[model samples]
Target: MGALEGRVAVVTGGTKGLGLKITEAFVAEGARVVVGARGGAGADGALAHLDGRAVFRQTDVRDPASVRALMEAAADRFGGVDVLMANAGLSRPGPAAGLAGADWAQVVDTNLNGLFHCVQAAVPYLERSGNGRIVTMSSALGSRPAPGASAYCATKAAVEMFSKVIALELAPKGIVVNCLAPGFVDEGMGRLLKQNQAVWSTYAPKVALGRMGTGREIAEAAVYLAGDAGAYVNGHVLEVNGGLAW
Candidate 1:
């Protein structure tokens, strides 16, 4: 049997990019997944091959009600929620001094506040599962600052600390909370950043692996955390950055 056989997982932003890869990984481990995103635009095209193992729900993680409905949908459909992948996030690149207030707010609202909403909404269902797992997405940049990624860095850093605090608070209820900090993977925002050779050149050598990480690599780390292998791990940030020097 698969490691996560009979488990139900809710993956925010699972319609595309890295989130989609994690969804696929969870499903491969025999978990039914509820994919929550702002819209179903990418759902049908991206998740059609999952053969009903993955379902999509309209969700705006920044809104508590939407997040709550997402968690409820998972329970109503799959019996109960066993895992929550709080992976909805965005970045508005600009220096702190010149960044627009709206841009900063947008990043903060989606990356940090949205995660909080999902966690709060999923807690009850997770508690009911007895062996609940929460994997919050962070970034290598959370601890390593970049020239024009102030908002992204700050929010991700906050995410790490937030995960740690909740791990403590939620342990008594049998819920495991952890953070997944990915380095420069060749997908999503990382892909966009790599398009600019000028920028990529500056950051390439810092990675000890000498190459960008794959989406599947990060997804596998998530699987390890959400499965029985991670039963004893809590309040820890798993960095899948291929040994980033900076």
Candidate 2:
């Protein structure tokens, strides 16, 4: 049997990129997946080829009602959520000096506050599972820094801390919370590097693996976290950086 057979999972932003890869990982192992995004906004709609294995729910995570509905959907369809992967995020260029107030607010609200709303919404369903896992995504930029990426970096760092705190609060109830911090993940987001190679070239020598990471590569770790293998692991920030000194 697949590792996740009969389990139920909710992957936010599951319609594309890392979220899509994570969804595929879970489904391959036989979990019933509920994918929620702004609905059909990701790659290939991020829903191609997984017809019977997953269901899609339109979710604007920043809204509490939308998030609650997405979480409740898993129970409605398959009887509760076993895992919640808070993976929806946005990154836009806004210089620290000239970044508009709204841009900062939008970024933080979506990445940080939105994650809180998702966890609160899913807590009840997760608790029902008797054993639940919450995996959130972060970036090396949070520990390091990029000149024009203030908002993204700040949110990621906060996400790491958030997961740690949540893990502590939920541990007694058998829920484990963790963060995955990737280095330079190229889930086609690397397309930007073609014209802007100089922007990230300095990171080349330090990337010990000598290349960028992919969505599937990152998902492997999520699969581990969602499995029993991670039972004793809680409040951890597992960095998936390829020995990259970012």
Candidate 3:
């Protein structure tokens, strides 16, 4: 049997990018997943491959009610939620001086505030699961600080701190909280960054492995944290970077 066999999981922004990979990994490990997304062609298309192991729930993580409904859907469909992948996020790339207010709000609301909503909404169900796991997504940039990614970096850093604090608070309840800090992955925003010649040239040589990390690699880290291997690992930020130096 797979590590996640018999577990029920909810993944926010799960229909695409790294979130999609995590969802797919969890499902492959025998978890029944409820994928939460904002609803789009990409979301629907990506979910088609999961067969019936995963259900798509239109979720705006910024809205607590939407997140609550998503958790409830998992319980109604798969019994109870054992894992919460609070991974929904966005990037508004621009210099701090030139960043637009809308862009800032969009980044903070979806990246930081939205994750809080998901965690709060899922806690009740997760608490009942006995060995619940909450994995929040952050990025290498959370600690690295790039020129045009102030909002994204700040929100991610906040998420890491949030995860640490909550990990302690929720440990007694049998829920283990952790954060995944991926570095220069070849998916989602990182894919766009890699396609830019100037950016790629600047960042590629900095990785100790001399390459970008893959989505599957990050998914494996998620599986490790969510599965039995991570039962004793709490309040940890598992950096899945390819040994980044700069």
- Give candidate 1's error at residue 102 in angstroms: 0.8
In model 1, the runs with Cα more than 4 Å from the true position are none
Model 2 per-residue lDDT tens digits across residues 1-246: 877888899999887777888999999988899988885655444566886678899889899999999988888898889999899988866788999889999999999999999999988888878889999988887788888899998999999999999999998888989888877777745546524678667767788988888888888899888878887889998899789874
TM-score for predicted model 2 compared with the true structure: 0.95
Ranking under lDDT, best-scoring first?
1, 3, 2
List the candidate 2 regions with Cα displacement exceeding 4 Å.
41-45
TM-scores of the models, in the order given:
0.99, 0.95, 0.98
Q: What RMSD value applies to candidate 1?
A: 0.7
Residue lDDT tens for model 1, 1-246 = 888999999999998989999999999999999999997776777999999999999999989999999998999999999999999999999889999999999999999999999999999999999999999999999899888999999999999999999999999999999999999999998998789999899999999999999999999999999999999999999999989998
RMSD (CA, Å), each prediction: 0.7, 1.6, 0.9
lDDT tens digits by residue: candidate 3, 1-246: 999999999999888889999999999998999999997667667878888898898989999998899999999998999999998999998999999999999999999999989989999999999989999999998888888899999999999999999999999999999999999898998899899989799889999999999999999999999998999999999999989987
- For model 3, what is the error of residue 25's alpha carbon versus the real structure, in angstroms, after optimal superposition? 0.6
Query: Number of clashes in every candidate structure?
Result: 0, 0, 0
Q: What is the C-alpha lDDT of each candidate?
A: 0.95, 0.86, 0.93
